[model samples]
Target: MPYGEAMLTIARELVDKIVAHGRADHPDEACGVIAGPVGSDRPERFIPMENAERSPTFYRFDSMEQFRVWREMDDRDEEPVVIYHSHTATEAYPSRTDVSYASEPNAHYVLVSTASEDDVEFRSYRIVEGVITEEPVKIVEAYG
Candidate 1:
């Protein structure tokens, strides 16, 4: 199924942010979100949330900030498009932790890794209570 165009952009930028944050911390998890409408051609918002700690191989997003963002998006008539996180030393696929936590079927789970920053991989998934079903992501560029 078509996951949508905006998710591709979100996936790309999320990789960049993850790389920058990883370089800054040298070896820590960088977590964030890409909140927008599901089927928009171009994304209208990109909100990055800070990870709670500086660690070697873990990322835990701040729940309070997450709630705040959800509210803000809801006010704008937008849904939680995708929940993104980075794998500092692993590949760009979901781990067991990721699978276990991806309970929202309506949202896409994006995972970026630092294996090759320039060669970033973007995969979309409909995660339902620990079961992940991969979804296809498509990008339609703007003319302007």
Candidate 2:
């Protein structure tokens, strides 16, 4: 945690959705983005994305879909606040490949682990230039 407080404050509904997506895509990695107002750093819109690789150990967003989503965000004056993926058999932490592919310096990288159905681990991190810093997540009923 930064400043001894939560670094990621997200809506409970959105949290539920992310966890559900992870659970539904069990045995395979799930990937998605939550777009927010530009420079807001608030993750507001949930956009579930298809994993182009469709592999349990790795994930890659469908390029065409990524293009469309980015265009839509541009039109809406939004940026990716959160870039999230699932870990089917591992913990909610960035893998080496994830660290290599993380390019959004301003976005929070969220990881959801579906390794245990009853205990779905949802963690947030900041991955900048290969440095990974774990942050605390605060799930609220809604953004106030």
Candidate 3:
């Protein structure tokens, strides 16, 4: 399925980060954020991080930052609206594990695929009650 515009931007940055991290670590997964308001036209921030997991092909984001930003956003009426992850050697689609572990039905799931050898492919999905659905995203210029 094709990703919406909003997701494409997030996916792009995520792919870049993943590839850079993959190269930097040679085998570990790199994690980060695709943060912004809910249903916004563009991503507001890209928070990159070291995949503390140190796995050759896995990513585990530190939630403290997520919580901290979420709380701050809540205070200002903005929110850390999406949880994005990169698939170092997989497609730009959610895996079964992603589906099983998903807890936010109201948020978007952006995936950046670093598997494309020549280029990165990014997409977005919405998981509700274990069912995954692709939504349309509009990639607007960066915004805060």
Task: Return the top candidate by lDDT.
Answer: 2
Q: Residue by residue across 28-138, what tens digits does model 3's lDDT show?
A: 555555455655534566556556677756666656765776677677555444666677776778888889877765567776666656776656777878888876655
Number of the predicted model whose TM-score against the real structure is largest = 2
- TM-score of the candidate numbered 3? 0.69
Per residue, candidate 1 scores C-alpha lDDT tens digits across 14-57 of: 44554565455545766666666655534446677778765656
TM-score of 2: 0.95
Q: Pick out the ten consecutive residues of candidate 2 with the lowest summed lDDT.
A: 1-10
Once fitted onto the true fold, the runs of candidate 2 whose alpha carbons sit more than 4 angstroms away are: 1-6
lDDT of the structure predicted as candidate 1: 0.64
Better candidate number, 1 or 3, judged by TM-score: 1
TM-score of each: 0.73, 0.95, 0.69
Residue-wise lDDT of candidate 2 within 1-144, one digit each (tens)?
A: 212233888999999999999999989999999999987778899999999999999899999999999999999999998899999999999999999999988888999999997898999999888999998899899888
Q: Residue 37 in model 2: shift from native, Å?
A: 0.2
lDDT of 3: 0.61
> Could you tell me how far off, in angstroms, the CA of residue 49 lies in candidate 3 after the best superposition?
4.0
Clash pairs of candidate 1? none
